[model samples]
Target: MNNMIAPSILSADFANLERDLKRVSEAEFIHVDVMDGSFVPNITIGAPVAKAIRKHIKGIMDVHLMIQNPDMFINDFKDAGTDYLTVHIEACTHLHRTIQRIKEKGMKAGVSLNPATPVCLLEPIIDDIDLILIMSVNPGFGGQKFIPYSLEKIKQVKKMIGTREILIQVDGGVTLDNAKEIIDAGATVIVAGSAIFNAPDVEQRIQDFKSLML
Candidate 1:
């Protein structure tokens, strides 16, 4: 399977976003994590910050909405220059409607599943989504350890999505050592946060992850 690397901005230096973004210029996408205190225990950037970051990034703006009631900000994020907008299955009451709404806004629609959520929950709308994000660790925070079960979940999702064009993305705790395994399990996109940003050499770390795919 072909592999792509997405450097999550959750672990980037907020004080110097431009510098951090520059470090990962080789990445295929800049994974922006939008967190709301209501849905998750922590809070992160919103549409405005995302828009600002969008201006400086050379790669695609892959925005992952970790907020509750994501429908309220779908249009806002689309207008803010999001290339791909992903929402959680647990958050949306009307998931199909939300996916349609995202597609209507001209952004690729993606659905994310938490560690505890089963891949079977996505069976109904799998065809409607452009991407599927499997969270290896609990959402809301970066630098967490990768959950071992997530590998099995990726395999199951890949089997469920057999022959489809959807992208299988694995987020949280992705590092040089584990990225190959994640891809071998059938993930096409890998979202690495602290593994890339917190590394002593950001550019090399990004290169290392890409080299694994090569």
Candidate 2:
């Protein structure tokens, strides 16, 4: 499996988003974080921005829905060109239906969990998902400290997905400091926002992260 780097758009400058996206389009995936104040403490972009981003980015749009009632908007996000639509398990009351909706719309379905959420919650539908997003830091913000327990969480999820082969994604606080540890712990994809966008050399920083896994 490929060790991947997904640069989160939350840290990208809203003013020069096109330019910033162009810089990181070379990475594995372009992560779009959708936040609603009701679900998280902050509010970020919605369908309009996602549609605009879809026009500019060629890589897969890993849309992370940090919003409430994600199922209601899954089709719209898919129409907005989200290659993979991930809904928070804490936010979805009917996870199976949402996952089915995503698949029905021809997009890969993913489930995300906050730091406090348990990996065992996915046991019933482990094979139904294409990706599992593990929040290494608390959601709603970027560049926070990587939680120590996240490593164990990744290990647990990995064992669960064994042979079934679902991609394990680690988001938040993903940096050179813990990239290798997380990947070794069973994460195939790493989503880094401030770590990449805030770096002086975006491509070089991504390369540095890739080096650690190699």
lDDT of 1 by residue, 33-58 (tens): 99998888899999999988888899
TM-score for each candidate, following the candidate numbering: 0.98, 0.98
* Regions more than 4 Å wrong, model 2: none
RMSD to truth, every model:
0.8, 0.9
TM-score of 2: 0.98
Report how far residue 208 has shifted in candidate 1, in Å.
0.5
lDDT of 1 at 122: 97
Which number leads on TM-score? 1
